[model samples]
Target chain A: MQGIILSNETNALTLAELPKPTLKPGQCLVKLSAAALNRRDYWISVGKYPGIQPEVVLGSDGCGVVVDGPDTWKGKTVLINPNVNWGASEQHQSSDYSVLGMPTQGTLAEYIAVDEDRLMQKPVHLSDEEGAALPLAGLTAFRATFVKAKVTAGKKVLVTGVGGGVSQMAAVMAIAAGAEVYVTSSSEDKLNKARKLGATAGFNYQGAEWVKEAKSVGGFDAIVDSAGGNALNDYLKLIKPGGKIVHYGSTTGKPQELDLFRLFWSQASIIGSTMGSDREFEQMVAFVEEHQIRPAIDGVYALSSGVEAIERMADSSQFGKTVIRMEA
Target chain B: MQGIILSNETNALTLAELPKPTLKPGQCLVKLSAAALNRRDYWISVGKYPGIQPEVVLGSDGCGVVVDGPDTWKGKTVLINPNVNWGASEQHQSSDYSVLGMPTQGTLAEYIAVDEDRLMQKPVHLSDEEGAALPLAGLTAFRATFVKAKVTAGKKVLVTGVGGGVSQMAAVMAIAAGAEVYVTSSSEDKLNKARKLGATAGFNYQGAEWVKEAKSVGGFDAIVDSAGGNALNDYLKLIKPGGKIVHYGSTTGKPQELDLFRLFWSQASIIGSTMGSDREFEQMVAFVEEHQIRPAIDGVYALSSGVEAIERMADSSQFGKTVIRMEA
Candidate 1:
């Protein structure tokens, strides 16, 4: 099986041939078609992922065909939910929920083993790459906006840094759910794409008063913050009293400085969202099937070029998910 | 009407002669019988409340008989549910919301006028001083445990700084709800009292291995953090995967460093809980009255000694709520 491995050496990626994993009871062998990269993958390469082990497979989101599994789950195209619980009856019900690509060897190889409990059937209409993109980034956005922030219809929402996969997913999903959406990006080109993706308004984050501009749409009912630090603090102030800010990742290294008084005074909440549960992942796949919400595939590369994908993600200038087809 | 005013510019608890307040529609004028002191009242006196007017009355929890008001609220005996609506509604339509002593005139005076919406009917069996002690601190603990943390039967919980009002309430309620409760405090006396309050175990905060002590009881399912600073970070590390730390006050101030990667890896949450909502306050009153959970009162001071009450609250050598009785 072909895969990418991160060594102890910084900023290095190695292409390696690994032996295919054998399946255990309650486990299924997935014939990989496509896998998507997450920001954590890059950080893992640099030892920024806490307590990570070396010489492991480096991708998390993927779509695969169940080549071998429990009879109930065999021979179907599926999306493997990344959160893994090894030694537990249920995936989410376990004591330690490790995501693929972090502590567990992920889905980067041509053949991978995963628990049946965390596998969701992929929609037949979408390509493998699109399905691959939906698990981590899509579910992170889905949970943060809908489940955590409760971005119901008729609410105003802000999705910062709309160029990234999570932010773009947030903008599109919030719009589909009847929320009025706004987007911000440093590049006009990225803002233009956000407008095309149904953002009701778009702004340049580089502007001195983009916060003021975002608030001109009126105080947001919710803000999904993949872009953190001052951007998050500004969103906190821009939200209406009792509104919420759903945070997933802090791409910026800046520490979050929030006024504790403002938090209680407005009855507001700062909710942290990581990834969706197995059940939520299933629900997200169902939504993608019903709404035909395709994962925006900004670029597709072969397995050998995974480093290029990570570099694009680090640049923070990518428009959407970057998927790597596992075939040569 | 005679009221206590502090000599400090914000409180000025010297005796003052003023006309009794006239109530408007949806408003009630309560003749103060007693009020409870929270540590926040001291913050109010030092001109530290974030957005309050000077010479403000400084109490958040009190109980009294309504002297006069619009027909809708006249002649009612009530506990002032001091969580005031900084907005028109509370988080989730419940409506007891406020910055409390920080942003509004409080309940310390001999008489106070309040909107009809913020008062809860006094439970028939409790004294006014007991009822007064049930609002700010009681509701804060209730919501932090029940509403925000969703503590349930069979869960393991850790309540930090036991014997203070919220801490004691959390311990007692956890016991009533069938949870395994652990208490951490600097005082062995307070720790013993917590055991009497039904905590399964109590650990001294000074124990360098309190984290190990917490884990020995099975890593906590949820932690209520009234104790802050590096303590919060240590408590956070003790949370089991997918567990939570419900934070309300940060007595130790900001500057506690956090490892965000640990939070994400363990799926641990730091949820901020202020006081419970208006409806939550009413619900808490019913729960306590039914369960016969009389809040532990350490000492009662005549309203004339409010300054001394504040001093006692700031001293931290005492346990339970300190009440200031105005009538008897």
Candidate 2:
């Protein structure tokens, strides 16, 4: 079988011939049609992610066909749930929980073995590329927006760093849920693109008076953020009383100069979230199907050119998910 | 009438002669027997609090007997709810919300005019001094513990800076609610006092590696904190997955070096709260009555010596609430 593996010998991710995985009880063989890149994959490739194991397949998002499993799952087109060992608690993941692709062998392969329960029927409205994009980023955005922030209709929501996969998904989902969605981006092009996707407005964060401008209009009921640093203080200023700031990633990697006075006085909440649980994954897929949501695709690469897809992600210029086709 | 007023002439708080408050429709005149000091009062005295209006009375917590009101309560013993104009929302206070001290006239006067709804029956278990100590600190602690953190039986709770009024009240309330409570303090004397109040354990935060020591025992399901500088990073490390860090004050007045990675992966929430809403104040008083909980009073000072009491609070050495008796 052909797979994209983080090669121990070369210290790089490369296409290599690997043995086909044998199915255990309750396990199914998935012939992956497409896979997608996330910031998690980029971090792992750069050796910045924790618990990186060599020789493991390197994708958490995939759309595939189940070749061997119980009668209910056999021959079904599916999107894989990347969350593994989610355990019992809906409040948080268990101690043993791990995402797919690093420590556990993942889905960037021609043939991958997965538990039957990890497979969900691919949304009929989506192509294989879009289906692949919908698992990890979709679930993450869904949980952060819906569960953590409790974003609903008539609420105003802000999605920061709108070019990223999860951030874009959050903006799209909030808009789909009838929210007044706003976005921020350093790139004017990304801001324009977000506006075309039904964002009520876009703020160019590079502007000197962006926070002031944002506050001038009105405060947001919820702010979905990935960049967490001095910018968080600005969020404290812009969030309404009793608003929620839900952060899934801290791309800036610095301490926050949060204004505690504003926070307590306004009774704001700063919540931290990551990838969602299995139940959230199901809800995300259902939402995508019901809304007929099409994921924004950046560029697609063939299996042989998978390295180029990761390079595009590393430069941080891609506006959406970069995908890899299994067939050349 | 005698009152402790923030005198505009001297730019200081002093005992002065003032006209007794007259009742408005739906208002009651309460003859205050005792008033308690909070950090808010100290901040206003030093011109550190926002919206400091000179000539205003400078206390929020008070216990008194209603001298004149409607037929419902003309001669009832009561503890005044310092949370005024709390408005509608249970999630957060309204924009018009203000604690009783600052811009509005407050409880330090010999007579206070309050809305009928702002009065709660003083618990039979408490004296005038203890009832005065219970309103502001008790409401803030109740909101942080039961409302924000959702603490319950078998939960492990940590109360930081346990010597302060609100922190001590939080420790007591969590203990009364059947949580296994731990406390942190730089003073061994304060830690011993907290343990006597039913904390399961105490950590001397002055000791090097205090965070490590706290983590060695186990992570806390909820941490009630007031000091929100770099110590917040320590709380992130000590919090269990899905834990809540509820902060009501930030006496340190510094930015936080929070661990974003730990925060997101653990799925923790950092909630900010000030004085609770009217409903929460009512609930707090009810909880006190149900538990027969008496607030810990540090010292009783005569109203003429209120300046000395403020100085005691300014030094931050008081082990519990400092009360001022009206009779000298």
Candidate 3:
């Protein structure tokens, strides 16, 4: 089997010949047809993610066929939930919970042995690549937008840093849910692309007084943000009283000088979210299917070119999910 | 008529002979029996609060007899709900909502004309001073503990800066609701006072590794905080997965270097809250009546000594509410 591995010595994702994963009890051996890259993969490759085990297969999103174990799922096409051991509570994951990649083996390989519960029937409307893209980023976006921020019809929603996989997915979902969607991106091209995806307007975060511009069009009911820098202060200014700011990532850094006065007086909430529970994964797939959402694909590469696919996440130019096709 | 006034030129709370308030339609002229000092009053006196109006009476909490208004009743004893024009949404106050003080004339007077809807029958078991202390701080604590943090039976709750009016009220409410309460304060005397109020344990925030000590007793299910400084980072480390951190004030200023990683991974929520809605104020009053909970009064002063009452908030030595008795 061929897969991408990140070793302690190299600290980089590399394609290598490796033995196929062995299935444990109640686990299904999935022969992956497609796998997608998330910022999580990029972080692991750069040695920034916690609990990075040396030489672990790296991918949190995949679509494939169950090749062995669990007779009920053996021959079915499936999408992996990626959120392992999500525990019992819907409010949050259990302490033992970990994402698919990291300590446990992941997709982005010939095969992955995942717990039977982590397998869901791939949304029939999606292609293998789109199905792969829908798991990790889709679950994250669903939880951040619906569960956390509670984005809904007639909502004025702002999705920030729209080039990333989760942000793009969140924008798309918010638009499909009848929100008046707005977006921010560093690149004009990405902003334009987001506008074409049904966003009412877009702004460049690098531009002067963008927060002021965002507020001029009536303040937002919810703002989904990934960049956790000083922009949060701006979000506080842009949000209407009682609006929510849901954050799933902090790529830039810590937000300095957070004006808590505005926060408490306005009664705003700053919610922190990550990859969602298995139940949320099912709901996300159902939502994508119901809305006929086809995840935008930036580029797909063969397993041998997996390193380049992960690198595409490093540059801010990519507008959507970067994928690796195991059978290409 | 007499009242405490804040003027631009003086910039100090001064006891002055004031004109008796004239009642308008749907308004009542309440002859106050007691008034309470809150941190909000202290902030406004120091010119820190927004929308400062010169010569406006400076107070929010009051218990009084309806000396004038409506055919319904003229001599009824009542507690005032200081939240004015709270608008429609129960989630947050309307844009036009204002506390009883500041831009609107407040409760720190012998006579106050308040809207009819702001009046509720005083709890039968409470003294005038205790009823006066129950409005602003009681509503705030009810919102932070039951509404926002959702503290419940068998849960472990933490109240930060327990000496403040809201924090003390929140600790009392959480304990009455069967939660195992903990507290943090700079003063050991305040901590001991909190334990007397049914807190299971108390920690001094000024002590070294207080967060570690807090976690050793099992992490908290929710934390009600008024001090919003770097202690937020400590709260993140001390909270259980899915726990909430509800803040009502930011006395110590911005939290430098908030760790976004731990927050998201733990799936915690940081909620900002202020004085609650009128509905919550009603619920709080009901809860206090049902539990026969008496607010702790630090000291009672005559109306002429009202300046000293405001000063008591600045020193942070008082264990509970500092009240001013109108007839003392």
Native contacts present in each candidate (fraction): 0.10, 0.79, 0.73
Per-residue lDDT over B1-328 for candidate 1, one digit per residue giving the tens place of the 0 to 100 score:
6654554443454555556666677788898888888877776555555554555567888889888776756677898877666344456334334544434556777888888888778888778878888887888889889887779999999999987888888888878889989988999999999898788889997988878877777688789876556675676578876677877777765423554545544556666677766678888988888887777888888877777678666668768789988864
lDDT of 2 by residue, A175-208 (tens): 9999999999999999999999999999999999
For model 2, state the Cα shift of residue A185 in Å.
1.1
Which ranges in model 2 have alpha carbons more than 4 Å from their true place? none
Task: Give the per-residue Cα lDDT of candidate 2 at A47.
Answer: 91
Ranked candidates (TM-score, high to low):
2, 3, 1
- CA RMSD of all predictions: 3.9, 1.3, 1.5
Question: What docking grade does candidate 2 earn?
Answer: medium
Comparison by DockQ, 1 against 3, better one: 3
The candidate maximizing DockQ is: 3
Off by over 4 Å in 1: A7-12, A18-33, A50-56, A64-79, A86-97, A101-122, A227-232, A254-258, A326-328, B6-12, B22-30, B65-78, B83-88, B92-121
| Clash totals, every prediction | 9, 0, 0
Worst 10 residues of 2 chain A by lDDT: A254-263
Query: What is the C-alpha lDDT profile of model 2 across B1-328, one tens digit per residue?
Result: 8888888899888889999988899999999999999998888888898788888888999999999998797889999998878888898888788899778788887999999998988999999999999999999999999999999999999999999999999999999999999999999999999988899999999899899889987899999999887888889899999999988889987565667788889999999988898889988999999998888888999998998788768778888899999976
Top-lDDT structure, candidate number: 2
